[model samples]
Each structure stands twice: as structure tokens, then as C-alpha cells.
Target: MNETHRSSTDSSEASHTEDGLSGSFEANEDVEKALLPHMDIKSGPQNIGKETSWLKLCSRWPFLVTFLNISLFIASFTLWLWPAPLRHPFKTQDYWKETSFYSPILERFDIPKISRVTNGTLYDTNPPSVLRQRIGKEADKEWHRIGDHVWPLVIGEADVKQLGKDPRVAVKIPEDLGYGSDAYIAQTEVFHHLHCLDMLRREVSYEHCHQQDISQCLIMTMVTQSTPPTPQTDLKTVVEARTREWHFHIYFLLQSPTETAAALALRDAVLRLRRDGAFVAVPLFRVNEFPIGPHPAGSYEIWVPDSSFSDVFFYLAANRGNLSVLVHPLTSSQRRDHETRNAWMGTPWPIYLDSLPSDGDVPLQYPELGLGWSTSPEQEISLEERLRRGAKVEALLANDPEAAPAPED
Candidate 1:
């Protein structure tokens, strides 16, 4: 009985030992699985959570990790030695921004440039034929333009007020000279220079670095403001009554039904005279304040500085296409001394004026005056002669309606 009991005890002890060994082996297997890199097992409570599949390592030891990485790098280099085909550098906004300095970069392109004359200076680009024709229609003979580019430039004379500060016509502005109070001469000089700008530059296109369309506006405005009275039967008779023969004087010819309007009309007409390259400038002229006799209501006497009279007369005769002109002989001073009483001339004499026309339209002149010049001087053609020439030309053309045609290939 004792022997059987001892055998049972030994069997039970062996079974307990076997069970303990089996449990320890299973626990070791589970631990090994957890430590392997990138294995499908959760690494709870780590900075890189179980979702971090992008980071895969074969070893748990720090040194082992270093060794593994070195091997991996070598393998990568070997793969690169026989590299795959290239791929696009970027696939998203974040990637694209990293590669490029933001698309749509700004850069300036060089282009040819040009300018248009206005107020005696060029401020805009010349237009291709397209723009030039359009602007010309509006300005008549008043503007000239040039181009560095395809743009059209606005051209007009600069005004006195704009001279000093404007990019154009500043040289003519007056500065204080020691001549002191009698600087009226200086004022006169300034006016003369500016008035000379009253004409367009002799048909050329110029250049300006930049542009402003002020001159065109100013010229148009000034024309409305300047005026003198008009209307008389004969411009020659009016001047003859004012001064003796061989004297210097200017004659204005017009027969205005309305005196006030005639004055305004004359003013506008004169301003636009330079629209045609003729009559470059109107010379210094003064209206007669005192008269020799009872002049008609619309008559005016314009005095020329004695010295300038020849210049005035010549300019008129050269440019006169119409009007009956008579010269009275009177010797006068071109310049006056600056004394009030002792001076023989109050001013370089003066042009006389008695009235203005009634109708206030300009560019609208009396057709009786032969040439359409708002200003003067056109080849000595008298009014009657001018009319006669027009009639003759019409008759000749009417007689031969079929004109000659040159041969063309």
C-alpha cells in the first residue's frame, strides 16, 4: 500500500512541472512578436503609435538599429545604381510651393516708346496711323505727333500759367532782373516769346519721356478769352485815317453786323491761325486808344512798332490770299524809352479798334475774306482777285470735265 501511494505523488509533481514549462514558452513567444519591427501589434502609449507603419525597423537594440540602417542605405544605393524611370517632382500645393517660388512671377518686358507734342513739349506716344487720323480730325492743323511705340500722343502749346512747373515751355518764364520797376520791358519780352509759341513748331515730330494732355485743353480755352472788336468797310482806309503815309501800322479787315460778337470771333480766329503752319506768330500789336477822327462803330486801328512795321507788312503781304491793303507812310519807333512825359511814343503805337461783331461764332468767319486763315499773309492775293481766281478755276474745270490720266501697269 505504501509503494502505490509514493508512485501517485511522483506522477502529480511531474505533471505540475510540465504545465509550468508550457506557460513560460507561450509568454516568450508573445514577447518576441511584440518587439519585432513593423509587426502587426499595437505599441500602446508610445510617441509613435501603432499607426506609424512608415517607420519600420528590424531590431529593438539601438546599435542593432544603426547596423540595420547602414545595410538598408547600402541596399538603396545599389537600387539607385540601376535606378527607375524619373517621376513628377510634385503632386500637391505644398509640394509645388516647395519646388517653385510661387508661380506667376512678375517680370518687365522692354518695348519701343514715342511722344506727341503738346504745349511745346512732347508728352505722349505717337499713334500708329489709326490713332493719328482720329486725333488729327479733331485738332485740324494744330497738332504733331511722334512714336516709339504704337500709342498716340496729344499735342498742343503749353500755357503761361503752366510754363514754370510744367515739363514744357519753362525757359520763357520771367525771373527778376535788376532793371527793377521798368521791368515792363521784361514783361513785354515774356509776352512776346509766349505769343511766338502761338505758332506750331515747323512740322516735326518730337519725343518726351512721359506725357500729359494739358496743352490741347489750355490752347482751346485761351482762344475763348482773347478778343478785339471788328468790322469796317476797308482795312486800308481805317489805317490811312489813323496815321500818315510811310508810317508803320497793322490793318484788320472785317465788316461785322454785330460789333461785340465780331471782337470775340476775331480772337478765336487768331488763336487757330497757327493750325496751319503759316503766320507763325502775330507780332506785337496795340489797339489805338485815341483816334484822329470819328471812326465807324466797328472800325479798329492797330499800331505796329515802327521798326516791326516792315516785318508786319511783309508778313501780311506774303501770306495774304485776300483783303485790300493800303500802306500809309509814317516813321515810328520800334522801341520806346521808359519815361512817362518825355517819350514820343506811348507804346510802339497801337492798332485801332472801334467795335466787335454781334454773332459769337468763330471758325465761322465772313466768307467775303478770301482765304480761310483765322490769321494772315498769303501770296499777295487781293479779295477781289482771290474771288476771281476761284471763279476761273471752276470755269476751267467745268470746261474740261475729263482730266488726263497717267498710264499705269
Candidate 2:
């Protein structure tokens, strides 16, 4: 009897549970039907089932939906329209006391000591045999006398006659003096200067003959003995506007073989101008394989007289190939001569301006070189003839100096 009672109780509970679910589903359908009139006709009946719950929520609380939409738009717009914040300047904050910071790795490192070695003796004290053989006994004995090299002996007949007629004099030399005919005179200071250089060269042994030592000796001798000219104490001071001389510096790269060869060729061409007794006024120039004075590159100087300035300038401008040329004046003010009164061919180069003097007399003069250069336009060699002779000299210079025939004076 008790078992039958338990089975009957179970069947009754199942029937009640099914009835409750049906009632709940019918209530939801009734709610959806009531909300359908509020929904838009454009939604159509087919979408009613899908949008039923959403439509009921919006109808009950319209302001909540509007507020949520506005909040979402503001968040999105803020993110889109807001400008990017700028980076702040970094400030070192005292995280700990400055004394607390320590770099153990850096403390262990030690700076390496640099050792410098300098060469003291550049040249030998003993004279070379080749240089000894070239020196004359009298010159060797008088090597201490700087004047011996300052003035060389002029024994040539033509040089003496030419010295008398030199244009440097205020008055003409008397024709009756018979300088060339009766007595042979010594050469001018120019030749003497060359002689002195040769004497200095002989002091070093051939094996010990360093170009730097020779150069340094000459520089030291000149610098120690030389003094600037005293300016005249006059009431009226006169400064000449025109330049008396000019320096044409032909530049080349010492490291480049081709450029060096071109430089040598150009030098040879200029030297050729002196051949065949032409362009005698063009003085002997110096070729510097390294930087000297204000020049910053390997260069050679061509000293141009005021009279032959145009001809020489034209020639250099035409001939300087892939090479830079610095044309500057020689004047009382070295700075002004190089800075203001200068021109360039090809590209310009930087020079050591501080090496030049601010105020001084012309550094070099023809009077010091030799007697004087004749400036008579008629006597001056024509540019065409110089060019022709230069070509021939270049050809001759290309061959061995010993093998080549001597160039005519």
C-alpha cells in the first residue's frame, strides 16, 4: 500500500511542473503582443520575434537608452578629437642620495699612460764627401761668415756690363768706368744667397742629409739674424695703392702621383721661360714639396713683377690644369696682400693667415736678389716666344738631364 502511494505522488509532481512552464511561456507571448503596437511598422512582422525583448526594454526606459547612446558617442568623439599630449622634459629625481650612486665597473678601469718618443739628432755633424767636393776652399774656411753667401763673385763679362745698365739706379753708371772690359765684378746678393744655401748643405754627410734639417737650419739662421726695417718717423705718411710684385702659387696634392707629376711639369714649363736668354726677368723660384709659410699644400711660387703681371697671369690661367692657383700681391701689409688683394684659379684653398705679418716692408725685393730687373716693355720677352721655349724645355726635361742636349742661353 505504501509503495503505490509513493508512485502516485511522483506522477502528480511531474504534471504540475509541466503546467507551470506552459503558463510562463504564455505570459511572455502576451507581453510581446502588447509591446508590438509601440514598435515601428518598418520593422515588419517577420522581425517582431527577434526585436520583441529590445522593443519592450526601450518602451519601458527610453531616456536610459538615449543616455547610453550619448555616453558612447562622447567617449568615441573624445578619443578621436583629443590632441596627443606632449612629452615632458625629463628631470633627474634624487631617488637616492647623490653620494649613494656608485659605478663599480668604471672605478676598476685605469687610464693608459701614453709614451712619447722624439727624435733629437736629425743630421750628422760631419760633412758629406759629395758636398765637400763641391765646396771651394775659401768658402769652406769662411762658412762662419754669413756675408760670403750673401754676396757671390760675379766674373762673367756680360753680367758686369748688365749690372752697370741696371734700371734700379737713380743715375746712369758712367760708361768710362769700363766694368766689363777692365775689371770683372762679383755677383749680386741673389747669387750669394744661393751660394750660402749650397754651403749649408755641404755641412751634413750625404747619408745624414735630411731635407728637413737643411730647411730648419736655413730658417733658424735667417730668423735669428733678420730684423724688421725701421719705419721712418715722418710727419706725412704715404701708402702706395699699387702692388709692386705678385706671388703665383701653383698647388698640387703631394699624395697623388698624377697631380705631383702635373705640378712638376708646370714647374718645368715655368723654368723653360728662362731658357734661350728669354724671360730673364723671371727670377728663380722655390718648389716646396710640403706646406710652407701660409700655403697649406705642396706648391711652387712664381714671383711676378708688376710690369710682367698681365703676361704671367694669362699664361698661368691658360696652363693650370685641374690645379688650383693662388695669385696674391707682395706689399707692405702681408695680411692685406693675401686677404683683400688676391684672386684664384680653379678652386680656392685655405691658408694659415696668422703666419703672415700685419705690417711690414715687402719681404723680398729684386735689389736683394741681384742687380735689378729691366722693365722696358721692348726688352721684355714676348708671351708667344716664352710659350714656344717652354714647349721645347718641357720636351727636354722629360728625358734624362745628362742625356739631353744643353739648352741654349
Candidate 3:
């Protein structure tokens, strides 16, 4: 009976121990849950404080931030608006800059002050047929008459013994001498010499025949150095030393209103030839933009390589029928290139030789020989003038039904 009572007492003490352990575990879990909320609240306020600080700093230095933004905007705007040419302005002005070094020399010689009255009359108003007929008949007679008097002057046989003898005989100086600056003093000397020759020629001619007015007649000769002298080289040596790649400039001469269709067809044919690797077609120039020498009034130029010269020449010769073609060689001397070596397919036209530039350095390769192709100033037709000319041509064609064939016919 005593052993059973002891067992019941031990069982009751074990149950009380288990209940105490369960209650302690529940209190520990509640404390951990309550601390998690405090940790989350503390982290949230810290993040908010960081963001507020940055906003406060910006608010405090508003003017500084605004100034920085404006400075950046101006820098970007300036970079965008700057001109490409102004960035390297010296490159474009290099030619002028080099020429400026000779300004002192030009001023010392009074080069720019010298001038001459050039023959600036245009006698090309007549149609080609009438002009050709007139040229054929009268050209030889006039050439012969001028040749007699001019030959002596050209050969340096003119009598200058009576040069300073006459007080009334004064050497008239031109005020504007183009290309005269190259050989300023030499040109002046030649002018004086020619004036003396003219006086003598007049006297001798009048003695033979008193029919023509000899008083108003004068022979003007302009002498200039073709190229500037090298430091240790003579003219003959320089001329021989010059080497150039030969190029043939073949020009197809055309006229406005009359040969417009033919010109266009020729241009198309030239372009087709270019595509076939035969020759390169050059752009057609306006009347005013034509080269200074005896080039066709309206024409399209084509560049034929030395290799294709024979082929191009033969083709053009056979196909050019009645169309004027001026084929000239490109040489080291611009003057010589145009004046000396040239072949004419049709009627040769008279060129104003005096109109070309007299003082430029000859190029090693052929240059585009046209107005505005060089630095020299030249007269150019404005857009308005070109438009007006086009309108007039259209008006004339419209009035004359026979000028061109109708589209259907």
C-alpha cells in the first residue's frame, strides 16, 4: 500500500515540471516577435533620412547647380554651332597668304598701278555661215596687210633712231596693265619701243600710200616673262626641265536655242562613253564662264587620256559632222597649251589671246581651264541673268514653230 502512494507522488511532480517548461518557451517566442518590429522601424527612418539630406543639400545650393547646368548647356550649344571652315580658316587662305609675301615687291615696282587698253570688242554677232564666208574671203587680205608692218616689229628690226628726236612723240603709259606685273619694267620698255616703231611705221606707210588714216593707228606690244626665274636656272633650262602629263581636251562647240537638242544628245553620248571607260565628260560651261582664249562660245569639254587619244580623235573626227571641235593639249604652260598645240575639226574661231592670265604659275598637270577655275577675278553671269536667257530662248522657240520638231512628229 505505501509503495503505491510513493509512485502517485512522483507522477504528480513530473507533470508540474513539464507544464513550467512549456510556459517559458511561449514567453521567449513573444519577445523575439516584438524585437523584429523595432528593427524594421529603425531601418525605415535611416533610409528616409538619407534621401532628405540629399534634397536639403540641393535646396541649399540651388544657384550653384543652376549655374553648372547653364554652363554645360552653353558649351554644347557652341560646339554644335561652330563653323567647319572657321575651325581651320588658315587652310583656305593659304594661297593668298603666300601671295601676300610678294606684295612688297609689287608695291615697290608700282606693278598694280600699270594698265593697258585691251581690245574688248565682240564681233561674233553674225551667223556662222556669213561669218565663215566673210572670214574666208577677207581674212587673208587683212592678215597680209597687218603682217607687213607687224613682221618688222616682231623681228626686232624697227628703226628706233628717231625715237627721242621728236618732242611731240610721247610714250603713252597704260594705267591698268593686266599680267604686266610679271615683267613690269620690261613691259614698260617694250611699250616705249613699240611706240617709237609705230611712229616710224606710220611715216613710211604714208610715204607709200596716203589713202589710210595713219595718225590714229598705233601698234601696242605687251612683253612679259612667261614664268618667274628660278634661283640658278635659265629660261631654256627651265622650259626643258618642265615635265607634264599629256591630256587632250576635246570640246564640242554648240549654240544656245539653235543647237540645244544636239548639245544634249552629245552630252548624253559623252556620258555613255565615260561609263564605257573611254573618256570623262566635263560639265558644259555658260557663255561668260568660257575660257579667255579662242574657245567655242558654248561648248562641252571632254578629257581623253593619252592612251585613248587615237581612238577618241578618230571617233570624234568621223562623228562630229559640221559641229565645231577644239582639241588642245594640256602642257606645263597654260598659254602655250591653248595657243600652240591644237587641232580643229570645223571652222576655227578667233581667240582673244590677251584675255588669258599672264602671271600665274603653270601647273604640272592640266587644270580645269574655265572662268572661276582659278583665283583670278572674272565676270560671271548671275542666276537671274541665266534664268532670263533661258526664258528668252523658250519664248523665241515657241514663236518659231519650225525651230524644233513637235514631240509626236
Candidate 4:
């Protein structure tokens, strides 16, 4: 009986120890489960309370978030709208003697001076040289004496008169006449000249159609001498002489095989007009035969005297076809003359500068910055020479202590 009691007690004690271990494990598990809501395994030490507070603050003041976003947007927009500083392609050479450096180089090198061969006689370019000074001198003198301007209105003369009588007449090119087509270009040229003429007629005073401005009227009213007025009184005359001296170079750019024939016909018509004494027509120059500096490609050049500027302008205005006419002023600088002060009747044809002599002298004032217009004037340096000279000038400036800038305070 004693042995049986001992076995039963030992079994009870083992059961109690097992039950205690299971209860302790269950309690520890419950505690871990409770703590899991506050802990974040992904975001190292838990800042859940701080994050929640921050989110609540943002919710309370939505305007603060909105303001920050708006400020960022405004800053970005301001940066976009701000204008960039002007960038000059060339560095200004203030002290450099451009004329002196270039002139000798041009003279030494037989640079192709801008000269036009018309009617077998080589006419000097707009700015005359010592060799060909007399070529266009007579025309120039006559122009000065009469106080007249030259306006070469280029277009195919209409068989019928009074076509563009109305200044407001809209130019109507046929839909079938494709771009750069002989018929289309011819029609367009006529339309452009007509429009220009109409505009001029409307703006110009009837009495002073020959003169560009009212300076002639001032001269007539103010001066009382058959003899030329003194330098002091002749300020207006000098000003008029400079400004009013315009030469309208009408160029008919021929492209197609048929267009050459058409151009010839137009040339003949201009000759006819000249024969009839309608106007003094400068001889037709085939651009290909005699490639003048910076002249448009595949074009026929014809000039009108200043005497018949108004009449010829009106006549051509009323009757022109697809020719491209480049009407530019005879300014002091040939480079600027073509570039800055010119009007086109039709789309300007790209000049083939590559075909022309590339190594010829260009003016110091007009540097060859790849602009094809930098042709060697009567007195200028070649593009290659100009570049060499430019490098020398830059080197000289760099070495000179005087050229160095003072440090800012």
C-alpha cells in the first residue's frame, strides 16, 4: 500500500510542472502580441507617434502645404521667364586699327573687286575705285543733279495695261503653279512689284514723287541760289543725297530651261523700252557668265536710271510675272547694302559663294563670319587674310598689359 501511494504522488508532481511551463509560455506570447502594435520592423526604432503627430499637423494647416507648393512653382516659373543676357558673336576690338591692318593686305593681294560687266563695259561697283571711277560716274552725277532716286521694278510686263490699278488687289497665284515654277515665280514677282508701287504712290506726295522725302521741298523753299549752297545751308541736301540715292537691282532668277527663254524675252522687252526712250535701261547681265559678289544665283540683272524711277516703277507695278527682283539701296557699305537695306519681290535664291573665288579680300568692317555677303569690296582683305589678321590682333591684345582689365573693388 505504501509503494502504490508513492507512485501516484510522483505522477501528480510531473503533471503540475508540465502545466506551469505551458501557462508561462501562453502569457509571454500574449505580452508580445500586445507590444507588436507599437513596434515597426521595417522602420528601425519606432517613431509612429511622431509620424502621426506630423500627419495631424499637416491636415490641420492645408494652406501651409499649398503655399510651399505654390512658392516652388512661382520660383520655377520666374526662372523660366527671365531673359538671358545678349550674346555678341564677335568680341569688340576698340583700339585695333582694322582699316590700316586690312588695306595693305587687300592691295598686296589682287582681290577680286566688286565690278559689274554690262553691255561689254565693266561698270565699277557702287563704291567706285580709282581704276573704274568713270564707269558709273556720269550716272551718279546725273542722279545727284536731278535729286532723283532709282527704283528698278522687276516683273513680266503684262500684254494688257491697268492690271494692278487697284493697290488693294490681292495677288492670286494659280493653285496648279507649283512653288519655284517659272509661271508661279513670274506671277509672284509682278504681284510684289505692283504692291510696292501702289504703296509708294499712296505714301509719296504727287509733287515730290521723284524725291524720297520732303527735304527737296525744304531745299527749294530755304535756298535761293542756282549755285550749290554752302556746307552750312546744304545739310538737308547732303542728307537727301545720302538717303535718297537708292538703286533697285531687279534680278530675275532663272531655274528651268524654259525660264531662260522667258528671261531673254523679258530682257528684250526691257531693251525695247530703252529703245523707245521710256527709261535708261542698264544692260542685262547674265549672273552665271559674270558672277558678281554676293549676287543671287541663276539671275539676270537689269537696272533702271533714277530719271524714270517713278514711271518705270508704276509701269512694272501694273504688269509683272514670276521674276524674283532684289531691290536694294546703294549704301556706303556694300556688305550692309545687300544685308540690311534691301527688299525682295520674291523668295531670295541662295547665293553659291562656293562657286565664286573664296580667297579674295573682304572689308575689315565686314568680317567674313561665314556670311556669304562678305565679298571683297574695292578696298578690303580676303576672308583668309582677315582671319589671320584677326588672330594676330587677338594675340597682340592678349600680350598688352594696357588691354588687361582692372580688378573689381
Index of the highest-TM-score prediction: 2
Best by lDDT: 2
Off by over 4 Å in 3: 1-258, 280-296, 362-409
Question: What is candidate 1's CA lDDT for residue 89?
Answer: 33
Against the reference, the lDDT scores of all candidates come to 0.35, 0.58, 0.46, 0.45
Candidate 2 lDDT over 313-376, as tens digits, reads: 8877888899999988877778667876789999999987655665666666565534223234
lDDT of 1 by residue, 154-247 (tens): 2112222211222232233233644332212112222333243333322323455111443443344333333222223343333322322122
- Tell how far residue 249 is off in model 1, in angstroms: 5.6
Count of clashes, each model: 42, 5, 6, 12
TM-score of each: 0.15, 0.32, 0.29, 0.28
Tens digits of per-residue lDDT, candidate 4, 1-409, equal 4345445545655565566765676655644543454332333234556778889997878888789999999999776544322222321231121222222223333444356543222333456432222124563454333333333222221311112211123243445755332121112232333344333333555563443233233222222322221222222223233432334444554556665565566667777887897875554454453334466545565554444556666655454466666665444455444655566665675553222221233322212321223323654345567657756877778767888642332
Candidate 1 residue 27 C-alpha distance from true site, Å: 99
Candidate 3 Cα lDDT to native: 0.46
Model 1 segments more than 4 A misplaced = 1-297, 319-321, 329-409
Is candidate 1 or 2 superior in lDDT? 2
- Over all chains combined, what TM-score does candidate 2 have? 0.32
Greater-TM-score candidate between 1 and 4: 4
